[model samples]
Target: MANTPGAKKAARKIARRTEVNKARRSRVRTYLRRFEEALSAGDAAAAKTAFVEAQSELMRAVSKGVVHKNTGARKVSRLAAALKKLGGSAA
Candidate 1:
């Protein structure tokens, strides 16, 4: 409950930010899922492409503060490992 005008405004801002962050997270997940699907399907070429795009999306999310820096780095590392296992160079 926001009793003051400033508090009410802050609450509204928080709500909007929450929605935006939620959408950003969901979009990041979608990009990761694309890479996962390609990896699981054993399509090295497709997985490589998806991994590149997902890496970009993940780093963007980190830059936007939607995700922590270390978390994003770890995710990128794991995906790169998986890509490497698929006989592709994770550039």
Candidate 2:
């Protein structure tokens, strides 16, 4: 319950930011899932492609303050490692 006018405005701002962040989060997840699926399918070409796109999207999210820089770096690192291992196992 927001009794004061400023408190009500703050609540509204929070709601708006939540919606924006939710969309950003969902977008990042979708990109990550695409990369995972490509990796699971053992398609190096597709996985690499997906990885590049996902990396770009992740960095964008980081620049927009939607995700932390270290978080994005870790995600990209893990995905790249998985992709590399996928090729190694196939060889």
Candidate 3:
């Protein structure tokens, strides 16, 4: 219960931020899923494209504070490794 006016406003702000963050997280996940699907399908070109998009989205999320910097880097690294293992150069 937010009794104080400031507290109520803070709660509202938090709710709005939560929604935005959730959307950003979902977007990142969607990009990641696309990359995974491309990889699994063994489409080198599509996988490369998806990897770039996923890495971009992840970095954007990290910059927006939706994800930690190290975490984002780690995920990108793993994705690159997977792409490499799939015979694609993650340039």
* Number of the top TM-score candidate: 3
Predicted candidate 2 versus true structure: per-residue lDDT over 1-91, tens digit per residue: 9999999999999999999989998999999999889988878888888888898899999998999999988987887788888883221
Best by lDDT: 3
Cα lDDT tens digits for candidate 3, 1-91 = 9999999999999999999999999999999999999999999999999999999999999999999999999999999999999999999
In model 2, residue pairs whose N, Cα or C atoms come closer than 3 Å (at least 3 residues apart or on different chains), thus clashing, are none
lDDT of each: 0.97, 0.86, 0.99
- Sort the predicted structures by TM-score, highest score first: 3, 1, 2
Position 68, candidate 3: lDDT:
100
lDDT of candidate 1 over 1-91, digit per residue (tens): 9999999999999999999999999999999999999999999999999999999999999999999999999999999999999988898
Cα lDDT of model 1 overall? 0.97
Model 1 off-target regions past 4 Å?
none
Ranking by lDDT: 3, 1, 2
Give the poorly placed runs of model 2, Cα more than 4 Å off.
88-91
Query: Model 3 off-target regions past 4 Å?
Result: none
Q: What TM-score quantifies how close candidate 3 is to the native fold?
A: 0.99
Candidate 2, number of clashes: 0
